[model samples]
Target: MTTSAALTVRVVTSLEEFKGLACEWERLLRTVPGHSFFVTWEWLYYWAKHYLRGNQLKILFVFDDRKRLIGIAPFYLRMTSVYGLISVRELRLLGSETVCSSYLDFIVNEQHKPAVLRGLYEYLFGEARKTWDVLTLSELAAESSTLDLWNELFDEAGKVGEVVGTSCCPVIRLPGDVDTYHAGLGRNRRYTLQRKTKCLQRAGRMEYARITSPREIDAAFESLVSLHQRRWGTRANGGVFADDVSRRFHREVVQVLSERGRVSLDLLTLDGRPIAAIYGFVYGETYYFYLPGFDPTAVPKASPGLLLLHHRIEQAIREGMTTVDLLQGAQPYKLEWSTGRQSLVTVRYYNRHARAVALKLGEGVKQAIKILVR
Candidate 1:
């Protein structure tokens, strides 16, 4: 909303301006057909507050002639070394590998794609060309139209981009009812799911609940982490709670999002004792499975983890969520449950500078060596 020109793109650097755009941002995000919760101000604002060390926020906004906000790009600038060899000034997305934001895309009104893309490029590569040497974005869904836009723009600009890594994100399409969803699954899988549900039933009263109350947030999150640790032991910490920073971000962000009715921390209990849990975010009628944890000591016959997933699905369907994004993984379980797989990719676009070319080449060589080794 803070801008000097009528038809120009604006760079939002101050936290005040970021906060001011909350209403418009959410409105624009909803206008977009397919978007993720990561683009939400609440999610990226806290991310910046916590893990944006040594980096400068460079969020971009594009407005129409009527001063209507149309597009938004959450970006940051930092100096990074490629494999600790070549140092390059990088302009990257708000979320990175460390943050585990499974998916990302700009919140752009489809009508203004051209203007937004052009204005953004002019700002980054023309007005402030020297500010950055390379542009990197990761975990973009392969089918994401944003990827296509970038590819088209970079192609038009005669710049070569590289695909550094790719992962499969499977998602389940929710049905009108849980029974219909179960019926849609393969007969074998349906039987397994039914058996698991019955097994849990035999273990006294089974209960499924979502934790959203402010008072219950802390205890629920602790139970989530504790059960996660118990299930994976040290591996849990390594995977999700890899460091104190990630832990701190989740602890605070979950509470913040839950307050807004955006978080869905599904908890499953067997006879009043927590057995399995999954951390999810509900945004725009889509459920994102961010993390999951279960008590490993639970009865194997019940398959507490799978049962929790089933319960979560039932809840999502009843709540009218259109899809359940399993994030990034090709696990057999995910494969069985997913209606289809979305490919997430990492992209790097180097400017026409010596350091940029060197860094790109160096990364290509490293990736090639890794492939060879594999």
Candidate 2:
């Protein structure tokens, strides 16, 4: 534990303690500016429930003199080996790795950002310095205030850190009306959407439905999984839902968020049979387009995937969403629809320990080799 002025910092390590924090956790999150769905309690908690088998929780909490929660660093520790030899302990953000969670950060009330960040820095690097060898914070939005503040702190402390560009998240800034949004699209895209919708309608009776009832979640989720697997079957890597654990994690997320009316699971059907599905979340004023699956064999010429996406965007516009986020990819389809892109980066900090020094040197050598090969 550590204290600075009117702030106190501490850690929560057990699952029960984490569970008890749901109310306070959400209260604090609401105060954060431009926070994403990935940082919500339901998302991170379910992720931890399914993915915490080999890792240890190190969630940090900050409070004011009045005992009000002010900040959260949802972190976990993992043991990683270098070259199958030396062991290194890494502190990582909880909703990372295989989940593809974007816009991750330390959830802090904007008013207490500096003080809370100072307390966190002191606690992590001062009192708890010996516990971790490296800190790896990934999937941070390039413009996130948390990213800027941490960069300042690391620079002041003279810590050995590197900020590396990781991925691009394409986004569409929506206008007030659906017709205006349609007008802004490129000519070719507008043509494709119109042609595809007409062709699909000509084929059969078409319907679009958003799954909201708890009873409908399981069946719709299974359909999503089947379509996702079928779409990726010919590719080298299998779909994300191929594993049972991942499926369970997402299922729990959708089930919990659905109660709050935040989950958006839409299916497009033809003649009473499902042809395409889009799974996403509605958080704040943005609609996150997280995943999509469509039958490649069913009316391939009609492009069911594209048509479903068009419908979702139209729905978002009508529902007062200001943005449509195609999270964590620069795929051609995403860029074609995007009006802008948010850059994501990974920040790595290595303490001056023997293991950390060796790892840093190894990383430098790898970079050198890559440059030479290029």
Candidate 3:
């Protein structure tokens, strides 16, 4: 049975080949609901040139019978570990770390999802028959057409795909301005926010600022790293600001996104010192929250983390944004401010080989552990 009925799938190997189609690819993504600025061509291009190097980062495009591009999925051949097992894995080029990114999915044009997925799956699996061992994608948003397309393709192809894990990406729906938001929270949450803001106000001088230019980019980034380390140093988890590689990756993304008006660096200062920082991207009427860290030692009474979030919520409303995506974390605090939630799933598509049997066993064990824990 022919999997691709009418679509043409093309593999782009050279950077030039990918760059030529970048404009159309980005345009097609804008048609998707809640499409992110993080997936923009500028951001991806910078990452490819600086970080990806000579890796087989396959940038694929699916076209309709009319030769119009309908979808894109930027994947790279790399190594990933799952439950003490390591193998060559095809992952979204955007997420190299099993760390902090909350969103990961293929770009599916609004008009063609299942069809695009079928073409992509057919191409990947057919190639995998001779090439790779496993294809994995983590942090796929449950609300996206990405999951729907995967489900459709697997059902039609009669292939087995397993869900490895699930997590929540929280989002706060902005109804009105800051006061309105505070009014909507639970009594304790409301009081906490009020008390925190008031405390900060009383302590010397407090200010909020957004950094969005190439010139101001350097200092803003340094402040983020310093604050992040100070906050998470106790737990010994370096957070996003831990090392040079992660910091470089972030700065590169920001520089690319800032030029396109998609990035913002929100800073909170107290007594002339930067106390908290947030790196977020704005796209399609929503603020996609990314890395945020605060000075845990400074003004513990002010609750700097919560203070930063409160300011961002108000900022969102002031900017007329419809929502603020808190990103993927099962943190209890996400529920306090979030009015809505989205589920993110980890996907494992098995190859028909010895690897498949191994993965099946691993999946069974994982499921058993999850059930026992529950």
Return the top candidate by TM-score.
Answer: 2
State candidate 3's TM-score.
0.86
Model 3 residue 31 lDDT score:
78
Q: Which candidate number has the best lDDT?
A: 2
Candidate 2 clash figure, as a count? 0
Query: Where does candidate 2 stray beyond 4 Å?
Result: 365-374
**lDDT, candidate 3, 112-161, per-residue tens:** 88778877788777754656556677777777777777777766766666
Task: Encode model 2's per-residue lDDT on 85-131: one tens digit a residue.
Answer: 88889899998878999999999867889888888888887788889
The TM-score obtained by model 2 is 0.95
Select the stronger candidate by lDDT from 2 and 3: 2
Which lDDT values do the candidates have, in the order given?
Answer: 0.80, 0.87, 0.74
The digit string of per-residue lDDT tens for model 1 on 124-153 reads 777777888888888887877777888888
Q: Worst 10-residue stretch by lDDT in candidate 1?
A: 365-374
Give each model's clash number: 0, 0, 0
